[model samples]
Structure formats: C-alpha cells, structure tokens
Target chain A: MTDTSATSAAAQAPSGVVDLLGLLAYAELVSFFRLSDAAGLAPDLAAKGELAGVAATEYRHYRMLHERLAAMGADPEAAMAPFVEPLDAWHGRTEPRTWLESLVKTYVGDGIAGDFYRTVAEHADAETAEAVRGAVSETERAEAVAVRVRTAVQEDPKLAGPLSLWARRLVGEALSQAQLVAAARPELAALVARGATGGDSGEGGSGGKGDLAAVSRLFAGLTEAHSARLEAMGLSG
Target chain B: MTDTSATSAAAQAPSGVVDLLGLLAYAELVSFFRLSDAAGLAPDLAAKGELAGVAATEYRHYRMLHERLAAMGADPEAAMAPFVEPLDAWHGRTEPRTWLESLVKTYVGDGIAGDFYRTVAEHADAETAEAVRGAVSETERAEAVAVRVRTAVQEDPKLAGPLSLWARRLVGEALSQAQLVAAARPELAALVARGATGGDSGEGGSGGKGDLAAVSRLFAGLTEAHSARLEAMGLSG
Candidate 1:
C-alpha cells in the first residue's frame, strides 16, 4: 500500500534517506533531553551520575546525525520536523512515574527502539548505517538499568506483573507513534518498502509483497525482538 | 569568620580541597540534569539541540571531577553529599517559568557560579584547580544563551524590567545558597579565608583581615563581577 505520490517520489528522489536520517537525528536529540531528566529521577547520586553520563552520549549521537544530514545538504531541523509531534506525543503519554518505571523505560522501551533503528540502519548507506550503529550502542548505564530491573523484580516477585504490564504499554505506545510517523511520511514508508522488497532492489519491485505486507513483516520482526527482550528482563510480552 | 576547629583542621589537612572539588563535581552533575531539562524549554529544535549539546559537556566535566575525587581516595557520592541540599534548594527556589527565564538563569545564574568557582579554584591544589577550570569553561551554547537574552531584551525593551528583576532574584537566591553552603562547611570557609588572606602565606598571618572581613571582601569581588556580567547582558544588577 504505497501511496501513489510516495511511489512516484521514491522512484525519482532519495527523500526517504533524508527522512530516515531526520527521524534518527530527532530521536537522538529527544533521548538526550529525556535521559538527562531520567538522571534526576534516579534514586541515588551514583545512579544519577550514571544516567547523566548515558544522556551525554545521546547528544554526541545527535551531533553526528545532524552533521550527516547537513553534509547531504538537508536542513536538520526541517528534516527532523516531521517526526517531532509523534515522538513528543509518545513521550508525553508514556511519562514514567517512579524510579523503577524510568529504569524499565530505559532498559525495555529504549532497548526495543534501539533494535528497530538498528534494523532500519541496515537499509541505509554505509556511513548512515555506521552512525546509526554507533548512536544505538548501549553503554554500561543501560546494562546497569537491566541489572537493576532484574534484581528489583527478583527481590519483589509481585513487581513483575506491574512491570510486565508497563513494558507492554510502552511497546504499544511506541508502535502506535511509529505507525503515525510512517503514515504521515510516505518517503520514510517508501524507504521501509524498499528495504523490505530486498535491499537495493528499489521500491515496489515487480513481484514483491507490496508495501503493506513488507511493513507487516517489519513489525513482526520488531515484535519478535521485543518479546525476546522482555523475556530476558523476566517479563512476559 | 574562622571557626577554631576549621583553622586547626586547615593547618593539618587538605579537607578544604576535597570540599571545593566535591562542590564542583556535584554542581556539574546537577547542571547536567537541569541544562538538559532546559533543552526541552527551547522554542525550536535547533535551540534544543544546542542546549542539549551544552548539557552533555556538563557530564564530561562531572566525570573529570569525579575521577579527581576518586584518585584522591574520596567517595564521589559522599564527597558530593554535603552540598546537594543547598544546590537543590537554590534550584527549587529559583525555578525558571519561561524559556527566556530559563535562558537568563543559565546565562546569569550559571555565569556568576562559574566565576565564583574559578575564583575559589585558585585556592585549591594545582591539579584540583586545573580540573575546576576545565569543568567550568563555557561552550558556544552559553554564548548563544547570552546572545539570545540580549537580542530578546533589545527586541522587547519592556522585557528588560522584569528580566532585570529576575536576574537580581537569581543572584540573591544564589548568594543565599552560597551563604548556606559556606556556613555549613567550615573547611570550605577556611579555604576562602586562606585565599582571601593571600594564598600560600600560611593560614593566618598578622597582615590578614581575619575571616569575616576577608570573606566580605571576597563577596564584594564576586558581586562586582556579577554586576558587570549583568550589564554585559543589558540587565541592571
């Protein structure tokens, strides 16, 4: 279900590449802000310092993505603008309430997003893909978040139910916003489409399962990875 | 005023150095959190990116200061614990309501702090002092904050009156907190007293102006610099 205009545009230009870069850059920028805020939510000074350190890396990643967009002659803000509202809405709706919620968000929610982006990066140019990989690299703070979550749930078995529900909600909210973004940005949709019908085979290949089927496959892959992450965290999807 | 205990301690130990480093390290950590929060208050994505970038530098500075403390066999969290309340109170009492107010806080509030710390750093051990200097160095985002404040005030002359009052409040709140921190940490007070009496001339000499008078003089110098900074931003102190 490629939009006719998006198909036309995808045929002639690489707006999808620009859209993808823009989305990634904006995501990094937002993560920088949110992760730093999460530092304040940390229960201890050591945790705060660790989260703050993690937040800094997000900014570095944002700079790299912005630079890549600019080198390609795109106004970074303009490129990123399209995804802003959806992302903001997702964050606004999914505000973490407690320190544990914040940790879970970082470990489970961000883990899923990181995986999705890594998959998308596979379809990008070499440099873009490398930047994506670097940006999504989980630091020790993330590992710490995972450790803390596992310990907390193990100590309080009752917490697993609430946290598991929270994790599911996070995934639901994330996927909803992702759909919103894809619906609004056909160029990005086309990029996913192109990536789906075999990499570099161009958008809407002759016998490909069309955009909707390809997008379904992409979501299925995302869901499978997300379930694996939840199970690792001792939570059911 | 030198407490009898602080004077005796200062004569035998470098607790003053630890206090100074601790204050600075904690300051960087809090700034990392708040500056990143400020990025959310930015009016545009570009400004958001810039503020977020500024926030990242604070974490790097925090790491350097934390490393210095760790190298000195100090527990970073415990060393930082003492000043946390005063700093948190200061931030709580002077929370910025608007984007412009947030900018003013960073430009005016943090400017005064950076200057005061630089002056205090001069009294510390060379390595600690060097680390202090490195942590407080302003990046372009700070400059951009200054420029934005100046331009906003210039564009709306009416804004100056309220902003000027806000600047005064920020300084007052900051000074009040500084007084609180100084009163609680006698070792830090002793460092100021020694620095005031002229560095490396021993703790107490016949030519010294005693602790109270010397502290008054130090505040005077800090006040003068603060006033000059406000004037540079076109705000009356």
Candidate 2:
C-alpha cells in the first residue's frame, strides 16, 4: 500500500515479496483461463479431461496465492492488477492453434515458469517456497504433459520439428514479457537477482543492483532445464 | 456398450441412466471450459476468481461423473461422446459477448439445467441422486451468481431488458437441445418422463409412454422456477 512510485529506496524489501506473490498469483489465475480454453483444441475426451484437470490445479494454485497475498495484507486484486496486461499479452501472442501446440505450450511454459519461480523461491521463506513449488507444477503435471507430447510426437514424427519451433516461440515471447514485468518492479527484480546468485543483502554481487551476470546464470539454468524437457518430449531443444 | 439404436425396448432401463449421466458429465466438462474462458471477460480479479472457482467445481463434478460411469461398467468417454454435438452446439450458439451476458448465462443456464437434472434425480437410485445433486450446484452457485448479476443490473437498469431477453434465449436453446437429445435416446426421455410423473415402472402415466401431460407439468414447474430466478435477479421473467 506504500506509494511505491520508485523501487529505489527498498528495492528488495517485503514489498518485493508482495509483488512476486502478486505476479505469481495473477500468472496462475490466467493460466487457469488459458489452459482450460486450450482444452477445446483437444481431439478426444480423454485428452480434454487431462488438460482440464491440470487447469483446475492451476486455479487451485491461484487461490492459494490469492490467500497468501491476503495473509500478507496485500490486496489480491491489486497484487494481480499489475500483471494482467503482461500475462494477457504473453498469452495473446503465443496462442496455440492445435492440440499439439497446446501441449507443447503446457510443457514448455510450465517448465520454464517453474524454473523461474524456483529461482525466486530462494529469496522467499520456507512456506512461501513450498507455495511457489505448488504453483510450479514441476513434479506431476510436467510428467503428464511429457508423456502426452511424447506419445503425440511418436504418433506423428512430423510434429516434432514444428512443435520445437513453436516451443521456441513460446519461450521467446515469455522471456520478453517477463522482462516487462521485471522492469515495472525493480525491487522484485533485484530480489530475484540476489537470490539467483546467493548474494548477501549488504552488497550487490557484481556491485550493481540486480547484477546482470547473476541474472544471466539464473536464465542459463532455466534454459538448461528447458532443453532437457524438450529432449524428453522428443523435440529439438 | 449395447448397440442402442432403438430405445423403445430399453425405455426407462439402466442404459437410460448411463445416457443421463453421460449427458451430465459432458455438460459439466464443457461448462468448465466455457466458464473459465468467460472469466477473461470479467472486469476485475474478484469476479474472475469467482467464475473460475465455479468452473473448477464443475470440473470436480465432471470427474465424479466420470468415475461413476466407469464404476457402472460404462466407458466414460463413450458415454459422453453422444452428447458432444448438442452441448457444443448450444455453447456455440450462445457464446456470451459481455461480462453481464456471461453472468446471466451462468445464472440462467445453471438454474435450468439443475432443475432438469433434479427431475431426473427422482428416478435415480439414492447414491446417484446425491451425485446428481452435487453436480447441480443449485444452492451455492445460484446465490453467488445472483448477487453478482443483481449488483450489475442495479448499477445499470438499461442492462435488464437485454439480459432478460438473453436469458429467455438461453432457455429456448436449452429446451431445443434437450428435445434433440430425447429424440436421439427415447429411453432417457421416457425415464425422465416417468420420474417427472412419479409413476411406477408398470404403467406410463396417462396411458402413454412418457405421458405428454406429465411432461407438460415438469416443464411448467421448470418455467415457474426459471421465472422466480429471473425475478430474484431483478430481470423480467
């Protein structure tokens, strides 16, 4: 509720956590919308059920985040408010045209977003970290999506090349939109950067706030994980 | 799994129950998609969350029906397959264009569907009736949707006329689709008819299979309830 016109004074303060939770909350909320809509592209009822089930989990994550924000005395709406446009824009740009495309998006998008959140989790306390893990869907859904995408790719080998390209597009659009989010809230960006490098609060790792090299390492890890996921799905990384 | 091309012999038999459960399952599944997608049209996060939460509930109901179908030795996917067209057609025709329109659709659509299912519930076994009640969402969701719609209508009296018209269209479309389904599967229709009239299996009430007079009464009750719902939402019933 502070007049955070600039993040200069408290770049990695508690408000940064609020902003992170807000962003994650809104992200999952929209994921619920986007994933469920994508279910329509499913060819069979079984696949449709799988996607819808995962989407329900996303809404569950959103509700958890919403509650967390309230427990922290942050306005859930306002926490999510700053995120609507960027998240919407990301979804707007990377809309899946086919069921395979939707599956790839689920696999790639959830994979990268989870890595990003896990990086941020280092800066958060234990409970918040667990909550972020719930939002990430790394363990269960990723495996389910992998099996689905892998089976689809095996059934139609032609899908792999195009799906890989589509996945790259998804990651590109996501990264660019993520930059917009980071720029709008420097404190959160700084906090995440410090967490990424395990930096002490007193000094920026590279003697600059949100050290570029540290952020580079963070995304490098995400990129590595993304490549592994792509390989698991029988798509080119 | 029987080749049920002719429903005459099996009218009011167990397959009729499968058909009903399948219809409900698919209805709720697609409802999950439609409602979550509609959440995007919400003006704010709270409204979006409310709609998405209800959509999640629908998915949970869908899962329950899916389990019930499997427990009954019916292939859940095969059971729901017959319903895809009519339900999809209904949604395709009645895609809501505005936030209020979506809310009105939710209210009217859920209200009528619940009543229709309740009429069927009477013929179902006790456990099945309870499950149907769970899927109906008559108590919690109706109140939630009403408050949301009423608040919107009070804020803009001009919306009342158009939204009321929209609700009527929803009911019309719903009834037409219901007839299509009944015509396709006479046993389910007959089962519903018998349930509507509280008749024993020995005789179709009024000396006809699925007595018209009883069906008339069933719909009269539905119409009356629909009007009361409309009135509660401050619309012309």
Model 2 error, position A2 (Å): 14
DockQ of each: 0.72, 0.74
Q: Looking at model 1 chain B, which ten-residue stretch has the lowest summed lDDT?
A: B1-10
Candidate 2: give the clashing pairs: none
Candidate 2, position A54, lDDT: 80
lDDT of 1 by residue, B51-120 (tens): 7866777778789878867766667788899989988888888888888998888777567557546655
| Candidate 1 CAPRI level | medium
- The most accurate candidate by DockQ is 2
DockQ of candidate 2, scored on C-alphas against the true complex (2 decimals): 0.74
Superposed on all Cα atoms, the candidates' RMSDs to the truth, in angstroms, are 6.0, 4.8
Fraction of true inter-chain Cα contacts (below 8 Å) kept per model? 0.96, 0.81
Clashes of 1: 0
Model 2 alpha-carbon drift over 4 Å, by segment: A1-15, A136-139, A194-211, B1-15, B136-139, B194-218
